[model samples]
Target: MTANASRAISWGEASARRMERQFLARPAGRGTRVAEVVAAMLGAHAQVLSAAEVSVGVRAAGVTRADVRAALWDDRSLVKTFGPRGTVHLLPAAELPLWCAALTAIPTGPSPFPPDVRVTEEQAAQIVAAIGEALDGVCLTVEELGQEVVARTGPWAGDLVMPAFQDLWPRWRQVLHRAGQSGALCFGPNRGRKVTYTRPPAFDPGPVPEEAALRELARRYLRAYGPATPQHFAKWLAAPAGWAALLFRELAEAGAVEEVAFEGSGAWVAAGDTEFPGGRVRGVRLLPYFDAYAIAARPRESLFPGEAYRRALAGGQAGNFPVLLVDGVVAGVWHQRRQGRRTTVTVELIGRRLTARQERELGEQVERVGDVLETKAQLVVGKVTVGPHA
Candidate 1:
């Protein structure tokens, strides 16, 4: 019924439109700024520092690694925190209040742990509070913070250890994400070689009702990766499908978004943002692992056709190796090896060939990648074996 308001948009058209929305088409050139780029992408993945830097560099033209670092550590304009899917991401610090409020609003259900490892609601609250209090004015390493948490909340917070990935982890560590989502904790600049944590004062505009927060998040997600189904939003945010579907309905009712047909399946886009012009996507790119642009796109089949998805994404996991993009589709997988000042970028075209011009552009992109890393890059075009992310 909602689709009646908008015509069907082909996958090709959608891809081109995404390139524009994602800044892949226009990019944040010299005139544009890094804040705008970060806001547009929603957030840049920062699990791999270099990957995050390259992600920002690609979109925010002429931005150096130092610029990004200053944004995070010095200027504090961008906050490094655990975001979407509980992954490290760089978010505009000014938007932290809204993001924190929205993310905390999502109901995480009851604790799934067995009694032996389960933390009571009261204990969890105390642990979260202790983490906040401990890092109010100073940063502390994980171990140091653990000690502070135990001092504040008592030994129960530290004594409880649960099995996690072959190693045992403190029960209170489970609430680290909750602390970040609550806006009471964030990443501090590394002290020498050790990671540290701090509590950045955030503006809490009182209580942001769940409905309001969900609506805002939904709107942003659509703007960043529109022509997407509610399922995609749910998957991206790790929210319940039924809950996401309900929010979409509310968004449609309020005229905040419009429904479009994506390959005959229903999709939603921010109202008045359904334009998908032809012949927009051009050139080649080397998108680093877990690049926000690559991670946010949905309907995997449309973005990665044939065996491309299987090769790039294994068992539904993305970011094994840097992806090679021809136009807007995944053309191959690539790996980068750096030693001293030289970086080697190895490309493996998976049954896809490029035009001479594209090859040149790819080479230029390799150079740019090197610049992002401050290294001299040597590109190797050959057969690259694909496998799981290390």
Candidate 2:
């Protein structure tokens, strides 16, 4: 932290700077390689497969949905699995070991399930191991794999049912990501209509010390989204506050990161990354639901000013709505629905209107979005409606 420096950047300005670092602004994302773009952004949110493709396509020049699919399924350059915050994400295949080592190290918070239904640590470990064994060099649907797990672990692994998504979910399903984080599983191509899982060929889990992994994760987070507070890092990673603070302090002492002032509060940025180019970022983009730009940013109040937060987020969840970005700040919420060969994109602008150039750019962006789905898009600008995407 060059604490004595006399520049206090506003949150809006800080966001614009992040846009450049995030590859959402000028010069655009440089590489044709999707892995490079995913690595730069840390990871691409993959809760919605199509949305994840659009996220990467927008950043990388001339990339498309098929390109991303090929990377995941055919070329095996990428893998879709559970990532930070226990959310689905697309990560570069080679970096899986590092991410898995670091992620598996974080202690899981207290169980959400009742004691009667919760799996014990020993049971959970057994289930994880069974999943690894079942999926080795093979693909199986969730139901098919359940039988395998029960055969290896026990009937208890498949017996407990807990409340989730307004329905009863198998207790053993909880360790799905635990298996992924242990280098035991990854998504495979769909079998007709069912999603399947498989093990990465030749993968042998290497020991990555917990503290070293945490330090590396912290360094990568700052490099990608710096000028951030430890609280921001904690919130984004779903890590405990005390642990994040101690980790930040360790990084600061090592000179890997430094503290800086932002609007009267202290925040940390990667060392040697304090310079901010002068001026607002100029662009109009339609970032999809769960796009890393919206999901990973902190101080949501600044990112979604006015009533925009209520409209873009639901019950404190990011990615509930697609976002319209004007100069790197949330301008509105949008929805895209497709039928047959056409897709309708409806954008409800809040208190602001676009200039002629911005409107034209938005049209081009709409075209790009349609290309991702292989459908013709018809854009509709309706009377402003302030609500979350449905």
Model 1 lDDT, full chain set:
0.81
> Over 4 Å off in model 2, which ranges?
1-6, 27-31, 201-205, 383-389
TM-score of every candidate: 0.94, 0.94
**Alpha carbon lDDT of each predicted model:** 0.81, 0.81
> What is the per-residue lDDT of model 2 for residues 1-390, given as tens digits with 9 covering 90 to 100?
223335876675677777777678853544558887888788898878989998888777667888889889888889998888887899988888788888988878888887988999999899989999999879999999999999998888887587878887677898888887777888888899789998865544676677788888888887677778888888887878887888888888899888777767898888877777566678888899789989777678777878778777888787888889888778888888889989989887877889999999889888888887778988898743545545
Candidate 1 Cα outliers beyond 4 Å, as residue runs: 1-5, 109-112, 204-207
Worst window of 10 by summed lDDT in candidate 1: 1-10
Clashes of 1: 0
Per-residue lDDT for 267-370 in model 1, tens only? Answer: 89988776677543877988888887678787887677888888788777666667888878888988888999999999988777888999899898899888
**What TM-score, to 2 decimals, does candidate 1 have?**
0.94
Residue 80 accuracy (lDDT) in model 1? 86
